[model samples]
Target chain A: MDLFGQYVVNGLMLGTVYALVAVGFTLFFGVLDVIKFSHGDVLMVGAFTGFTAASGAAALGFSHPLAQLAATVVFALAGTAALGAAIARWLILPLKSAPRLNILLATLMLGTALRESVRLFYPDGSNPKAFPALLPTSSWQWGQFTLRADSSILVVTGVLVIVGLHLLINRTRLGLAIRAVAQDEETARTMGINYTLIVLVTFALGSSIAAVAGVMNGLYYNEINFGMGLLLGLIGFSAAIIGGLGNLYGAILGGFLFAALQMIGAVAMPFASAYKDVFAFAVVIALMAWKPTGLIPERASDRV
Target chain B: MDAAIEISGLHAAYDKADVLIDVSLTVAPGTITCLLGSNGAGKTTLIRAILGLTPPRAGSVKVFGAEVTGEATHRVIARGVACIPEGRRMFPKLTVAENLRLGAYQEPSEAEIKRRLAEVYDTFPRLAERRNQLAGTMSGGEQAMVSIGRGLMGKPRLLIVDEPSLGLSPLYVKENFRIIEGIRARGITVFLVEQNVHQTLAIADAGYVLSGGRVVAGGTAAELKSNAEFHAAYFG
Candidate 1:
């Protein structure tokens, strides 16, 4: 029982990170019909930004763990938000009239460019860099069910952020504008909603969330690498697709589902635990083939 | 008379194909001006050009006497023009209230938005009852109400309604025209585009007929109603 509980906790923690990344994909897909293939690299950029911020803060004598964490998060989110908006405006918007495949390939190439730039520019970035331990190294035990203090903190923060996002999307005027634009771009424009501004804001918001996920990932794993975003991005995109592309709740659900599948695969086939992705992906393919719209298909009709 | 919207010598195209050529029209403040045409006569194109969705190749489009020929759609809307597009394009997945709230996207204050919401609700009690319902779930007549209510939420000085009667039953078509008349009664200038000639002319102050990308006829509604060419072009 305790072993099962431990796996569950681990899966949930990992799922939170996936959820954050998946939500970004869902949001981008909601506003723009295009999937941002470069999103995973954006998250990587965010992790690197946080890493640099943490190092700079430590060098400046802001040695307290909380202070370092705060600085890391703030700088990373802001930097990633700006980068996301720039990519959307300069990279995505200009290709509005181009063939859809062209945009997809362009974003794919942009992701490659970002990954290479980080690897080439940052000193020894191709090598994994040790992440700073900003989280408290403590654990709480309850009758063989142990929880690491840092993991607990991350879990609680992730839940709060997700809840906050739900409110921002459902209860705010900006959210209303976003939904309007998502539903019908031309009508939203005629209703006086600035299309460009909304698209930029959506990109910024999604990237900022990915930044938080990136920092949390580094803190949890204690290491960061330039190529880390590739697999993580693929996993996040897969999660979004399985959850139902463009559906916010579906993204989070898909994240947890993917994590659970991985955990189940690990426990059920201990000898081949490394092939968890293969198992999860096989199940996802079956699910997709069975119900292609996903678990919670988008409510909007496909008819134009 | 003050012009709410004025277009002169306008030329517009979609890609390489020209749709509007040397088109000139004026919508007087507080009057319903109808643009009548058959299918493929560039009526929708003309509306798109006026809203800045399609930029005119040559000519001036002035709203309240200010030149706004090539402004972005949202910017033009911010200058107090709202379009109830053809087919009553409501965000089907969104609630009736959400659709209405988006109409006031430029209104900065919550109080103003609330006031507009109340006003729209009062105007269309059917929409008020179904405010929380998804627009797609609503009946066609109800959807039209939500669309018109959304357009009213902007408190626009000039409301451009493109085919308000499309896909509606005869009773709903009458109701739609009545609502358009009410909008004109509220002192809002209306630019109506439609192929339903008789019903549109019944309520319009002035009318223009377009054919082959050109304004072939223009007169007061009564004059167009009496003219043999207009009658033959439309009814025959």
Candidate 2:
């Protein structure tokens, strides 16, 4: 029973990271109707940004762990948000009238560029970098189960962020404008909502959220690589798809579901646990075939 | 007389195909001006050109005497123009209240938005009752009411209603026209585009008839009502 509880707790922690990444995908898809294939790379860049900020803070003698963490998150979010807005303005908006496939290919190529840049530009970025141990390293033992203090902190932070995001989306006027633009672009324009501004804001918001996930992943694993985003991005996209691509709640649910599947595979499979992704993907493929619209299909009328 | 919207010698196209050619019209402030045409007569295109959704190839479109020929649609809207686009494109998945709130996107204050929202609810009690309901779930007539209420939320100086009567029952059609007339009575200029010649003419101060991408006729609503040319062109 303790073993089961441990797996559940571990799965939930991992799921929170995936959920944050998946939410970005869902938000981008909700507003633009185009998948940003390069979002994973953006998260990688964010992690790198956080790494740089942490190093800079340490060098500047900001010795407090909390200060280092704060600096990392702030720099990562701001940098990634700016990058996202730039990409939307220069790359995505110009291709708005082009063929959908062309835009998809463009974003895919952009992702490759971003990945390569990090690998080539950063000093020895090809090697995995050790992330700072800024989080508390304490652990608690209850009965036969053990809980890490950092893991608990991450889970609480994730819940708070998600709840805050929900309020921002549901209770604010800007949120109302976003929903309007997402529902009908042309009508939104006639209603005095600026399309370009809203699209840029959406991209920034998604990118910043991915940055948070990136930093959290680094802290959780104690290491990050240039290629970490690739796998995480794929899993996040899968989570968004399984949960229902344009549905926010669905994205988070899909993340948890995927994590649970991996956990189950780790325990149930006869082979090594590395085969967990294979098991998860196989189940996702079958589930997708069964219900293409996902667990919570978007309620908007399908575009003709 | 001050014109609310004045278009002179306008030419517009869709890629290679021209949709409006040498079109000229005037909408006087505080009066309903109807643009009458058959299907494919470029009535929608004309509205698009005026709203800057489709930029005119050559012409001037002035709103309240300010030249705004190639401004973006949102900018035009910000300049006090609102549209009840064809099909009443009410963000179907959103609730009626959400749809109405979006109409006042440019409003400055939360209190002002609340005021406008309350005014809309008072104007359409049905919408008030169903404010929390998804817009697409409403009946066709009720949807039309929501669309009009949304336009009113903007407090627009000039409201362009494109086929508010389309797909509605005869009873709803009468109600829609009555509502349009009531809006005009409130001193808001209305640029109405429709194929329902008689009903549109009954409430319009002036009317223009378009055919084959050209304004073939223009006169007072009464003159167009009696003109044999309009009858042969439209009714027949």
Q: lDDT score, residue B173, model 2? A: 97
Alpha carbon lDDT at B9, candidate 2: 98
- Model 2 bad stretches (over 4 Å): A300-304
For model 2, the docking class works out as medium
Candidate 1 shows a clash count of 0
| Least accurate 10 contiguous residues by lDDT in model 2 chain A | A295-304
For model 1, the local distance difference test gives 0.90
Candidate 1: regions farther than 4 A off: A300-304
Q: Residue A168 of candidate 1: its Cα lDDT?
A: 87
How does chain B score by TM in each prediction? 0.96, 0.97
Each prediction's TM-score versus the true structure: 0.97, 0.97
Specify the CAPRI tier of model 1: medium
